[model samples]
Target: MLEKLIDDFKLQPPHAVLLALEPLRAISDYVAGIVGPAEALPRGDGHPVIVFPGLALSGAATADLRVRLQQLGYELYDWEQGVNNWPDADFDEWLQRLGAHLQRIHARHGRSVSLIGWSLGGIYARELAKKYPKLVRQVITLATPFTDTGDSTHAGWILTLLNGAAYAVDEALLKRLSVDPPVPSASIYSQTDGVVAWQGCQGKETRCHRNIEVNRVSHMGMVHHPDVLRVVADLLVEPC
Candidate 1:
């Protein structure tokens, strides 16, 4: 299984120099968001949308994105799970809690929810949608390497540290993760992403699935890059 994971998803992480420039590129993306001409976007139909943060990040990390979607008239919801530190001893419990949260939101709105996840958060979004397809309207993942085991990410060591020997590949989980969710879904990635290998960030494209690439966006910048936001906006308002 490990050999297969290596063979199938063994793309190299971004160059060290690119990793070093990530913060600068993120700043540039922020500036561009401020000065770029407004794009004409379709208004959201007030469906509930949830934004999930990346590993070790709290929902606060997605504030700008949430605000943008909210302005488009969508009801934005936080992950509300605090920092996303997955693969902990309580990982199953945490997922159960998340499932219950989703259930409550679905009950409250009486509508399927849209999920947007960044980095590792995107992995969670896909799995959640898979587990409860009837409750999800669509999914959009930003720079998430769901097709790869930790081998293709700069953050691989972080997962190793967190999971110890337990971090070894789970073929079943990997197989599941690599499959696109059963709802309308899009993967937004960048060739210049400086954390995870971009090749692992996409899946097979079908009528309801897409791999949209942006140029020169850092892995960390995907949450706020204007190009990424535009793609996300267009996908959100797409007819279901």
Candidate 2:
């Protein structure tokens, strides 16, 4: 299953992928700009844009992102509790903690916030959006393996915990998070994403929700890729 995804990425022109996903990204960002708070939030913005780092990402990875967003003229909130590695964490407890933070950001910023979660953070962002839609203005998932009912692509550690949890991809959850004709979300992928299979990052529907593929960017670098940054800036700087 992953083989085709990878091959297609290698075969597909990244420029074409970016062209495909740009519309949806623009739409989501535009809506967020309209509904989201419009002040140049202080450092961390009080409403604080939340960012979730990718697998094995260090502070430096998101460091550039934070700085870039700031340079682009937007405030971002710190996860404070960084690098949410896929530990054997209690799902409910984790959500609670994250939810509490969202509440805190909302109380402080008094505006809808955007979630930029990389890979696993993308999944986390989706769950959080469902849990607190009122607080979330938009969602961006980077190279996240949103759908992969195959064990072939997972790392060894993952297989140990979800040896056969392929079916656990949860269509219900995907449906709930679908930002189609109405919802606002973006799933960014790269033809060279060394991590999760590119196919796994796509959205089957193109209307409201979309899967965007950028080129040359590695799964890790996608978090900071210039093209990715421009897309993000475009989304963040809109009217909302």
Candidate 3:
């Protein structure tokens, strides 16, 4: 299974058609939220939840989902840092800030906080769980490429250009990042993802780990997808 997943990770960029359709599909999903029937999922316990946006985007990219989660009784918090531009600063410094953010949330809530990250943010979420397992209740990723970063993303060239030497992914790092987090985690991906391949998004699923797929959704649209949001809500309500 590992070998198969790795082979599948020889990722390809999204097709022109899929890329072209992203805006329309995202708009449709947004419209559906208003005109379609809402799923009656159970409410959250008001636990503090922090959401991280994707690469090159901002916390505002996740606002819709965060607000939805908040409406469901979860205490939503932003990453605070404006845009997720990987090129602007040192990765280590960015991680330090995340660590501090997690600490603040824990201090305020008196409990481990759940983490939700999209794309690159998901990679951050997983590493955070590994470094501070006791402080993270659960981790949820939307279209995050974990198996191999370089080969998994359609935006590899962009990352290479922006991150320069830091974007390089060696075998040791790939093997390490592919491992599951110590806490409960789920990877939500789409086979037709236009940014990263679905195979790289999958990890070894165990009792506490899961890989979920939705049909016909773009990578960018995963953030607002109704089904994916439902899965996140369900996972958050589970016992810690």
> For model 2, what is the error of residue 13's alpha carbon versus the real structure, in angstroms, after optimal superposition?
19
Ranking by lDDT: 1, 3, 2
| lDDT string, candidate 2, 1-240, tens digits | 999887655422234454445445545434443343344432333335788776555455577677767655556866656555553456667877888988898888788888888877777777788778888877777777666433323443444445444324345644553433233677888765554567767777654466777765565556555667666666655443
Candidate 3 lDDT over 1-240, as tens digits, reads: 999997764656567677677778877767664442375867999999999999888998999888889989999999888877652545556677788999999999998999999988898888889888999999999989888556556666767666565466668767777888999999998987777767889988899899988777778887777777778888999989
TM-score of 2: 0.69
Per lDDT, the best of the predicted structures is 1
* All candidates: TM-score: 0.91, 0.69, 0.88
- Which candidate order results from sorting by TM-score in descending order? 1, 3, 2
Residue-level error in angstroms, candidate 1, position 39:
2.3
Error (Å) of candidate 3 at residue 136 is: 0.3
Every candidate's CA RMSD: 3.0, 9.5, 3.2
> Per-residue lDDT for 10 in model 2?
49
Which lDDT value does model 2 have at 147?
Answer: 65
Query: Candidate 2 vs candidate 3: which has greater lDDT?
Result: 3
User: What lDDT would each prediction earn against the true structure?
Assistant: 0.86, 0.63, 0.82
lDDT of 1 by residue, 13-90 (tens): 889988899889988888776654276766899999999999778899999899988989999999998987674545
For model 2, the local distance difference test gives 0.63
